[model samples]
Target: MGFTQADYEKFRILRVTHVAKRFDELIADESNDALLPEQLFLTAADDALAERAANRIERAVKAAGFPIPGASIAEVDYRDGRNLNPVAIGRIAATDWAMTVRNLLLISPTGGGKTYLACAIGMAACHNGHQVAYMRMDQLARRLTIARGDVIAHQKLLSDLAGVDLLIVDDFLTVAIDSEAASDLFSILADREHRAATIIASQTGPAQWAIDLPDKVAGDSIVNRIANNGRAIQIGGVDMRQVRSHEVADAL
Candidate 1:
C-alpha cells in the first residue's frame, strides 16, 4: 500500500521531533523546495538564535547523565509558563539569563513533555556554550543523603549545584521536602539567583507544592521565593500516553 497524505504528514512531523539544525534552515527558502512541503517546514521547523545562551542547564543534565536524547528551545510550551499567554510562538529564542532574569517553571502530569522542553532549552544553551546540569528531585535528595557518608562529599554536591549557569530539576516535588533537603534547595536557588537560571519540572504546581512537601511552612516559603525569581508554565491537554500507544498498536 502507498503511504497516504495522513501517513506522510505524521512521518514529517515525527521526523522533525528534536531534530535541531540551523534554526534559520527550518524556514530557509532555498533550492531544497523539491524535498518537502517547504510551506509547512518553513512555518514550524525550529526557532533559535545564532548565539548560545550561557545557561548551564545542559551541563547539569550531562554531568548527571540523564538519558535525554537532545534538547531544543522549540519544545517549550509558550502558553503554559508563568506568563499565562503565549509569547510569540518562537519568541523563546530570545530568552536567556542575560536578556531576562526571569526563570521557568514546568508543571504538568507525567508524559506531558515538560522534561523534553526543559532539556531542549538546556541543549540550546549548551550549544551556545553555556554550562548546564540536570537533576531530578529524588536524585538530588539521594545524592545529598549519600554524600553524608563524607562531610566533604555533601559540600561538593552543593558546590556542584551552586556553580552551574543553568540547572533543571525534573520530577521536583515528588516527595515531601524534609528540612535538610528543603534547606539545601533554598540555598541552591538563592545562590543561583541572577547569576544562573534554573528550570523546575514538577507534577505539582506552586500552589500544590507546599502541600506535597513535608515541611509545609518551609516548602511554602521556598516555593514563594522561587516564584519570585521565575515564571510557571502549566501544561494542560489530553493525556498523550494512551494516544501514542494507540497509534503504535494500530500500526502493529
Candidate 2:
C-alpha cells in the first residue's frame, strides 16, 4: 500500500505500474482474497517486466540501422569446410565484451558469411541490453564526406557513433581509405578506443591494411587500435551463397 505511482514513475519502472493497476482491480473484486504483501512485490518482479525491457531493446537495435533483418546467433550454420572455431565464438558470445570496450575482427573472403556473422553478433549484443549500430565502411565514409564542411553535423555524427556499445563496420578497408576518409575514420576509432567496442568485417586482412590505406601512418594507427586488443576470427571456406544457391537449385 506504501507503493505510490510517483515512486514507480520516478524510478522509471513503467512495467510495475501495470502490476499495481492489476493489484488494485484484484483487491476491489468482491470474491477475491486480498493480495498478500509479498505477492505485491513478486508481481513487480515477474516476467512481464523482462519482456517489456527486451522489446524496448529490440526496437532500439532496429532503429540503429542494422541491414540484416532477423539475424541471430542461433541462426548461424556451421557447415563443413568453414574453418570457424566454435569454442572461440562461444566464448565471445557468452561474455560482455561487446559492452565492455573490447573489439572483434571478422576476416574472410567475399560470400563467406562475414557480414552475416557480424550482424548476428551485433544482434546478440542488442539482446544483452547494449546499444548497437551497423554500417558499411563505404557508406559511412560517404556520410563523413558529406558532413565534412559542416562542423556541427560532423561532430554530432562522431558523437553518435562513439556512444554506441557495439559499432559494427561491415566491409571495412574494402577500398583504399584516402586522407579525408582516413582522418574521419581515425576520429571515430579514437573516440571509441578504450570506451566501447567495435566489430569490423573485412575481406582484407590486417597485414594488407597498410597497403590499402592511402595514408600509411593513419592506416597503421587505425590498425594498431584494432589489432592491439581485438579478437580476430578468420573464416575460410567455400562461399555459403554458392552452397545455398545449389540447394535452391536442387529443390527447384
Candidate 3:
C-alpha cells in the first residue's frame, strides 16, 4: 500500500539506511552483485560502489599530481585481434613511471590515432595510480606565449606543470619552438627527468623535427633528452583522419 506523506519519509529513510548497509556489505564482494535477485530491492544509490572504484583511481592519480580523464574519454582502437602493447601497459603499471624518467614518442602521420593513443596511455597511467597531464605542444606553446604578459601568473602556470607525475605533450613539434620557449621546454624536461614520465605524440619523427627550434644546440638538447634511454612507439601508415573523411564522403 502507498504510504502517507509522513510515513513515506520514515520508510524512505529506513530504506536508504538498509541500502547503505547492503552496499557496505556487498561492496567488499563485487562479484556478488549478480546474485542480487531483484534490482528494485537493491538501493537506488547502488552506483556508490562503482563510483568508489572510479574515485579510487581518480584519487590515486591525483595524489600523483597527474592528469586523469575528464567526464568523457576513451581508449584508441587497434582493431580486432590487435592490442596497443598491453604487455607494456602491464609493465608500466607495475613499474613506478614517476621514477622511470622514460619518455614515449608516438610518431604517426596525423589522424593515425596518435593523440588517442597518448590519451589512452595517460588514462591507463591514471588508473594505475600515476599522475598524468596532457596537452598538445602547439596549444601549450600558444597559451604560454599569450600568458607571458602576466609574469606573476605565467610563472605559476609553468610551475604547476612541473608538478605533475606524467606530462603528455601531444602533437609535439607541431610548430617551431622559439629561443625563449626552447629554454623553457628544456627546463621543464630537465626538472621532469627521472621524476616523471612524458608521452610525446607527433606527426613528425624525431629525426624530422629539425623545424622545432632555430638554435640547433638548444633543439638538439631537447631531442637528446627525449631519446635518452627513452621508448619510442612509431605509429606509421596512412593518416586515419583522411581515411575516415574519405569514407564519410563516399557514404554521402
Every candidate's CA RMSD:
12.9, 3.9, 7.3
Task: Please provide, for model 2 over 152-214, each residue's C-alpha lDDT reduced to its tens digit, 9 standing for 90 to 100.
Answer: 999999899888888889999886566998888888899899988889999987888877888
**Ranking of candidates on TM-score, top first:** 2, 3, 1
lDDT of 3 by residue, 137-248 (tens): 7777877887688998778768767778788887687777677777778777877777777778888877776555777887888887777757877765756677668989
| Better model by lDDT: candidate 1 vs candidate 2 | 2
Quote each prediction's TM-score: 0.66, 0.83, 0.67
Model 2: residues with Cα > 4 Å off, grouped in runs: 1-15, 21-45
Error of model 2, residue 121, in angstroms: 0.5
Task: Compose the digit string of candidate 1's lDDT tens values, residues 111-146.
Answer: 776777677766665655556678888888888878
Query: Residue 24: error of model 3 in Å?
Result: 9.2
Please list all clashing residue pairs in model 3, or write none if there are none.
66-131, 66-132, 67-132
TM-score leader: 2
lDDT of 1 at 139: 86
Sequence-dependent TM-score of model 1: 0.66
